[model samples]
Structure formats: structure tokens, C-alpha cells
Target: MRAELPLAAVLLTVVACQSPTAEATAGPSGVVTWAASADRMGDGIAGRSYRLVVHTSVGGTDLRIRLSNAFGDRPITFDSVYAGIQQEGAELRPGSNRRLAFGGERTVTVPAGSTVWSDPLPGRLPAATDLVVSLHSPDAGGPASGHWMALQQSYATQGDHTAEESGAAWTVPTGSWFYLDAVSVHVPAGTGAVAALGDSITDGWQSTTDLNRRWPDYLARRLQRADTAVKGVANEGIAGNKVLADNPAQSALNRLERDVLSQPGVGTVFLFQGVNDIKAHTGVTAEDLIDGYREIVERVHTAGKCVVGATVGPFKGWHEWDPAAEAVRQEVNAFIRTSGAFDAVTDFDRILRSPYDPARMLPALDGGDHIHPNDKGMQAMADAVDLTALDCDTIG
Candidate 1:
């Protein structure tokens, strides 16, 4: 649903001027049940049709999708767009596939650094179903707006096959999602969502692909089953992302509004970041990272949302970990636990660290990478979340 933002949020709406941040990220009247943080991919292609398969968290009618050209140097046009249920690889469930329109037009162009949402398609979607969004961009090029590490494999073809239910023509398989960023469903009144903002761990790096096993995915399932007001989940993580600096992708601080607060029905933000900044040996002190956390809490509060802070997990054997970084992690975790800066805290460090060696990750949960968590670790992180903390209005 279209949410009204305070005048100060004007600066945060980096999308097109005509489209407000709230409407672009959240549907006009529904909560964003699924979203992927958008970043610049290699480049867009003309006549490229993508059949992206994404799992839903909450069920509702009138589903909508948001397409972006946020990083393009020039305007891009999408000639045809369709949404359907995925039957299998590059194949759609017959008769479930339907067309999507933007402002009553079949064709729409999104300017550089902007996004657009499709008119809600009429139908009911069940929770946990695989929803496929297929679209063909007639004239697409320049730095494409997409997520680089989807971890889930989707399909692509050379021509406009968006309207077809067959998978015969969709030959290319891709690991990243292009253009399509956010999806929403018209949920019951007062249904809120939680957006997880972090780095690779939250981005589902070590999690199983296409299985929806990211920590956020597990949290989504939890929210769906619980009697809480929050049922939607948005994963706003990026690999190699930092909290205070913009390099691999925009820093968590920089993209907070567009990726988190702008999503409709989002009442809480889960902040689990900082390892990259510490382990990178950037001379960032514990105080520095704490300030970043404080700023995030303050901003989220200002936006009328609660913040849930997570302690940085141990990474003793990672290539970049060092004594100094470990010290910083401990100090930061101390502040997160005792400072009360956040409305709530999730002790991921306490949950994932080895009892024998606090600096190292527990062997069973280490996904072969000392820095990233395994599937079990991801589930543990999600299970550790206090679901009640996700709905600020209800909790308050």
C-alpha cells in the first residue's frame, strides 16, 4: 500500500520524482512480502527475457512487482512483463501466468536511477509458493540495476518469452536477479514486515541456492507461522558490503531508506553488519562501528520503526581476522548488549561462537567458510530472533 512519509524523507526517495519512495518500494496498499536489495550488475540487454523464481513469505491477493533502472546511465524500457507460478526450471504453471501493466500501459520506461511498480494483478497467492516474474526489456543496456549474488539460479533467453508457459526457449541460467527488485501482496490490515540489513551472511552467501534457506528466509517462515503482526521479510544484504563505506555496494547506512524504511509495512529493521569493516583492517574502532549502529537506530526510530541489533559473529579463522579485529568485535557486542540503543538485540555471536574458542565459529555450523554460516547456523540465527520485537506498534 502507498505509505505517506514525512517531508524530511523527500531526500531519501532516490527513485523517479513522480514515484514516491514509499509507493516504489511498497505497493499502494499491500506489504512488501519479498524484496532483494538492488545494485549495479554488469549491463542490461535488449530483448532479454528473465524468468526469475522467488519464494513468497506471506499469502495475499493483488500481487505486485517493482522493476528498477536505478544504476543505469540512460533510460531503459520494458516492453512486456508477466508474473506467474513457477512449475519448474524456466517453466510456468499454465493459466497462472498473467500480464502486468504500469500505469495502465503495457510498455513502460524507467529512467536512470529510478524504479517503477506494476499494477496489482488480480489473484490470490499462497504462502511459500514459488512466484516467477518474467519480463523482456526492448531496449536495455548500460550498468544494469540488479542484485549480484542472488545465490538462486534463474533463467534467461534471447527473445521475448515472457508470455509463454513453456521452458523450451529459456536456455541460459543466471545466478543474479536483474531489474526486478521488490514484490508485494495485499495482506490483511496491520501486517508489518522486517527488513534484514547486513553483509554476505544476511545475503545468503553460504546458504543453499533456490531453497530459501537464508536466515531471513527462515525468519519469514517463522513470521508466517507465528501470531505476530509482522509477516513480511526483505533481505537487504550485499556481499563485501560495509556499514560506513560505499565500495562493493552502497553502505548499509547509505541505502537504509531505499532498501529498508521505504518498503511498505516494514515496522522493524534487523541490523547484523560490521565484520567487513572490522576485519578489513580499515582502522575502524569499536566506537566507530558503534556510532554507525547508533545512527541506524536513530534513523529507523525517526521513520517510526524499531531496530533490532545483532552482535557480530566470530570469525577467528577467516583470512582477514586478527587480534585487533577480535577485540573490536567483543567491544561492539558489549555495547550492543548493554547500551540499549536498539529496541531489541539478537546475540548471534553467543549463538554461533565455539565454547572452546570464543574467537572461532562452532565447527558444526561453519559452512566451510569461517566467516559465513552454514545452513544450520543460518537457521539458528533466525530462530534466535525475538519475533515480537518485529512489530513495533504491537509491542509498543
Candidate 2:
């Protein structure tokens, strides 16, 4: 008699064969899922055209792709979607490319507020390459909602319903899919993983949907150029996460373990937290915040991983801004600058602050809120990181 695989077991075996373990991170031990989303209210209009840019470091022999509409109010219909390698910093022009899909077919219907991954495709990515993903719509669309994770390249297609051509090398148009998620790739062993843990800035709001402009994506490009061993980055930043409790959504401490420690093969941790903690109403004292930092540091260290701390930047217009908070900000900066707890430090304050008005934010970097950094500021944030800090030998 021959042994048999149960239905769920058969599904698991198929996923394993597609994604594989050596080229994958440790997790539920199966196919890696990818997705993205959009909304109608204030994000984009229904029936409007939109595009998505996703960066993947999964350089493997076999791969699969998925798009999401999990946030839409109605079923998202797709007309045409294009995938290819990015040429010159998200410029969706000509490059080595091909039309990708779920098992060699086109046109998919993703239910409202849901996700869809493509059947496995033979995608072989070189080290540190940026994959450009663009989508087109022929009708009024919904408010775009998707997280900025991956450490590679991403871009969005523009125009309302009749806008058609998304300015790609191709001229065809596709319907629309609200939720665009994961693009999993099969890989080999010894690949390094990136963990970008922070707040809304890292989460990517108002930064042009599908542009993939999150700072970590730039870091991914840098890492790819410098070391192929570094695979990809996992973005764990929540829109309102704070270092301490400001509110549940705005608290980084509340989600650190779930967001950072829980990620698979998190070889390095890059922290850009604490702004919300200080900006929260009735914020804690500098010493109190320091104690919180100490606790977080201990937990991260206990996980046998290295952490890079980011100093808080100037935020005079925040609700909690006051002499006491400013003083605390300086205190925290001093601690981050000198503390041996962190393996390295990235001074975002130094990168985006206005020298002309040191107390104010740099107009170019500030996203009109005088708090969150704009796309340019996000780029500066990525540039501030010393790529070598993620080197295994350096941390280990």
C-alpha cells in the first residue's frame, strides 16, 4: 500500500515545491503571499486608473505573483496588468520583460477588499534588481490602500478611467484590482532578510500610490548592489506606531514583537520609532521614555539580533510639543547617539532638519505637516543608513 497525502497536505506540498525552503524565509513553511490595496473615498475615484510598483529581492528559479483588492467596496475588475524590470529608478520604460499572469492567462476578477496571487512563473532575478509593476483602469477606481514593504523598486500607473496607457513600454490597458499584495520568489540558502520597523513614514502615506518610494526600498537597491547575500526587506512600520503609548495604533512598543521579532529570519532591525511617543498628549518624561527604550533594547537583544536606533527629529507643530518635550527630544537624541545598546545609529533628524531654521523642518522634506517626511525626505532617510551596518559579521 502507498502512503497518501491529505487535501491540506497536498496543498502544502505543492506550495513547498513552488517556493521552496532554501530560497525562502522561516515562517508557516509554505508559499509566501504578496498583496496591495486601494480605496474610493479620498484615495482615488471609482473607475479611475491606478498602478502599483513592488520591489522583490527573491532571486530564484521559480516564482509567482498576486494582486489584491481586499479593501475595495465593490468587486475590482482587471483589464490588463504589466510586470517587468525597472530601468533607471522606477522609470517604467523599456527593459528586459514579459507579460505575467496566473498560469499564462490574462484578465482576473478580484472580489472587493480581497487578494489574488498568480500561478507560478519562471522568474530568475539577479541580485538587487528592481521589478516594476503597473496597472491600468477603465472605470472609476477606489481609494488606494496598500502597505510599503519590500526593499526593492515600485511605481504606480496614473490617469482616470479613460486614461488608458500607464506610460509603460506597452500601450495596452487593464481594468483594476484594489488590493495588490505579495510577489513571492523561490531562492537558495544563506539569504539575508531586512526588517524596517517604524511608523507612518515607513508605512507610506501620500507618497503617490504604487511608486514604491518608501526609504527601505532604496535601501534594498543599495543592499543588492553591495551584497547579493542580502535578499529582501520586511517593512513592519504601522501608520501610527509610536515608541511608547500615545494610542494603540500610534504605539510602536505595542507592536514591536508582533511586527519585528515575529518576522521570519529577521537578521537585522532598523528602528525609526519614538516620534509619536514624544508627540502624544501627556507624553512621558525623557527619563521615562529612556526606560522604555531600555526595555525594548533588552527584548530585541534577547532575540539574538542586532538593532540600529534612529534619533527622533524636530517636530514643533505636534499636539504634544512643548518645552518639556523638546528637552526630552534632545535627551533621547543624546542617548541614541551614545548608547552602546544599539549596533549602529541613523540620525534622521540630522538628515531632514532645516539648517536655516533648525527648530523647523526642511520644507522640501516635510510633507506640509512639519512631521512626516515627504518622498524626498524618505529617500534621505534611506540614504542615512550605512548599508554595511547590516553585514552579518558586523552585528554577529
- TM-score, every prediction: 0.93, 0.62
The digit string of per-residue lDDT tens for model 2 on 313-366 reads: 887765657777777788888999997768888888898788986656788888
On lDDT, the leading prediction is 1
Q: Which candidate is the best by TM-score?
A: 1
The lDDT, on a scale of 0 to 1, for candidate 2 is 0.58
Instruction: Give stretches of model 1 more than 4 Å off.
Output: 1-27
- Candidate models: Cα lDDT each: 0.86, 0.58
Q: Looking at model 2, which ten-residue stretch has the lowest summed lDDT?
A: 5-14
- Model 1 residue 47 distance off true place after TM-score fit, in angstroms: 1.6
| Model 1 Cα lDDT, one tens digit per residue, 107-179 | 7888888888887776677777788999999899889999988988899999899989899999999999999
Candidate 1 displacement at residue 43 in angstroms: 1.6
Candidate 1 weakest ten by summed lDDT: 6-15
